[model samples]
Target: MVVSSGPLNPKTASYEFNGISGVLGITFGLPLLCVVLNQMIRPDFYIVGLFTNLDIAELWNHIKPLKWYLTNKELWTYYLTWFGVLALFDVLLPGNTIDGVELRDGTKLPYKINGIALTSTLLATLTVRWQLTKGEMPELQYLYENQTDLCIITVIFAFVMAFFLYAASFIPLAHKNGKETRERILSVSGNTGNPVYDWFIGRELNPRLGPLDLKLFCELRPGLLLWFLINVACLHHHYLATGEVNNAILFVTLAQGFYVFDGVLNEEGCLTMMDITTDGFGYMLAFGDLALVPFTYSLQARYLSVSPITLSRPYLAFLSSTMALGYYIFHSANKQKSDFRQGKLPHLKSIDTKRGTKLLCDGWWGISQHMNYFGDWLISLSWCLATGFQTPLTYYYSLYFAALLVHRQQRDEHLCKIKYGDDWHRYESEVPYKIVPYVY
Candidate 1:
């Protein structure tokens, strides 16, 4: 989801796909993929081996009890409770109000940037609860054991929330002149005149409830915090199962935990990012920020819990270097772009476009148009590699991430081509790479 912030070009903003089929496939396909991946990564299943053996009987036996995965009232309760608490915290917590990028209407919305404080408070509260309960907190192991159910619940919630947002978009704001006007800002790309398509792509640019921006809140808060908690739960589960925690599990837990923490710490950066700046708040984002991110991103840690793999010093060193390099590139490139946008890097080499925007051609942007994407992919690779080569299913994060980033890069480039036209071509010619420098 990390991408460079581009100018708010309404003409460039549109539905990611042209037709209904692509939308339908991803809408239905993603949830199914999540289920399949989670199931295949179980200790008993050898996902790679299943391809060669083709155990239809065993697969059918496993699939027959699909009802078991559906019935988990406790999980539903826990998820709802957690979401509610976070929403409450988002509203009540005190933080600096930062104005976001100027909109098509020439107005900048103010967003509260209290993510770090909220994360700190939430973690402290959870730590106290765990300590006071003497590890008897049912929610701890319950999350790990009923992960499938939790994921299902999250998916359902995303659908419900998306529907609610879509329906809310039509509500009219009462005016003083006995007139009704909808204050909802429609996304240029998402206003496809088709309900289903718009619903999937998100019709509203920024759906809010009072001062709480629903899309922004969801992007940084619930799913990300839950991801870290899930990793912790998996680590605890591993310890409970095997008298001690393995280095592999610990590495993944810490790595992902730090990533989530750092994201929250720099929460203001998201205000200018593509999600908030251009894309509409829809089911695609809701499902991704909620179900896809937490459940799937923590797969490596989850897999380690069931099948622990102790890494040798050599392997650990390699993974450490890989993750470090990825972080360095990702962070530095993003900061460079952000600084350039703010006019803080005037001396840096850039191409002045016809649209009155400067396209960076130096620093990380010089290396690749989307170097941050490559770094992000590398980080994902390290997480999967931490699990060793035991199961191909564990590498799903890196594989899917690569595809997602490539699609995003294509989308960004298409938008830039349309917006900047000849200037974009000149910039591209100068940069000469999309994501991997000479390798690309």
Candidate 2:
């Protein structure tokens, strides 16, 4: 009878890792495995490990002797053993699932996996790909004779495991929730039929286009990631056969995890699934944020691996700093608003003059009503700049993100105007300018 020292409790095997711990484990373990796999298989693909004090060229020159470890067959076997262990542990851990309603006819929907679970599976495949490719694709002759069965089996296994884990965890979660999502939805009353009917009838009369319908669309649903994932698999078959996964594939697999995790943590944005569904454009836009930008624009490694980024390290670092500031502002402002709404913090009225018991306008929100958005744009610019001075495709994502946020802001303003009436206008007057401070 022995007790383990790890976070997982042996007494209750059902226990799992908390959010931060689980994320940290994945972050460290998964990337390390990818790097190790690469080193073992295609040791020629380099790492730019610059210690805080060391210079880049000096470090690269220093590590040149250890390069032989890359081609060692035995090293790869060692790496794969660990990779398999982590991958199995990741799948077996039984993570959180999102259980929403089946809006039509008040039926209960079962637990569908939240985004992080789905994204992890994609990353595992990329890990396998980089391992197999070892940096170069196999010749067609070798593919047919030695490795076709292995490739097929790997692909089928990865797909089946990802799907199985997702279904197993999510279905039960949804079943347990039992129509709560539906109740939240149905509680909001409407008479002009569904969103389509409301759109046609209300367009002429309302002009501003009030809540047309409450029904969340299939396209807007995060479940649509399954479709995008399928398409990616189809378009890149050879990568699987040779284990030479594309650089774009790898970048996207990582970036998507960031997007999904961000959405989950914010939590309020999840409610927006129902909030903006009637706005077909908003729905499309959300899909773009969750899926397209992550998959497409982050394709920098695939296209520009050979190209040189014109920006210097310091400049990029400065840009990254500015972006961090923006995220701080955006996140801080949102936090303040949430606190005020939840009554966790006392609401201050103005920046220079704090009217008792109102929102604190002195911090990030003090600069402007939507200063957070400015910070967001700054951060986005930093990311876009890091992609090198390449074609617009790389930067398009940031641009689209800005446009979407602005549009969302406008929508929020309109909704506030209708709901808050005179209070919104008064609030606007007090907090002049939107997004950028003193500029717009």
Highest lDDT against the true fold, candidate:
1
| lDDT of candidate 2 over 101-165, digit per residue (tens) | 33333333333233354346555765676579773423322322212122222222333332332
Clashes of each: 1, 10
Q: What is the lDDT of residue 5 in candidate 1?
A: 56
In model 1, the runs with Cα more than 4 Å from the true position are 1-15, 54-72, 174-182
lDDT of 2: 0.40
TM-score of each: 0.92, 0.47
Cα lDDT tens digits for candidate 1, 220-283: 9899988998999899887777779799999999998888999998999998788888788999
Off by over 4 Å in 2: 1-125, 128-260, 264-269, 272-296, 299-311, 350-362, 388-393
What's the alpha carbon RMSD for model 2?
18.4
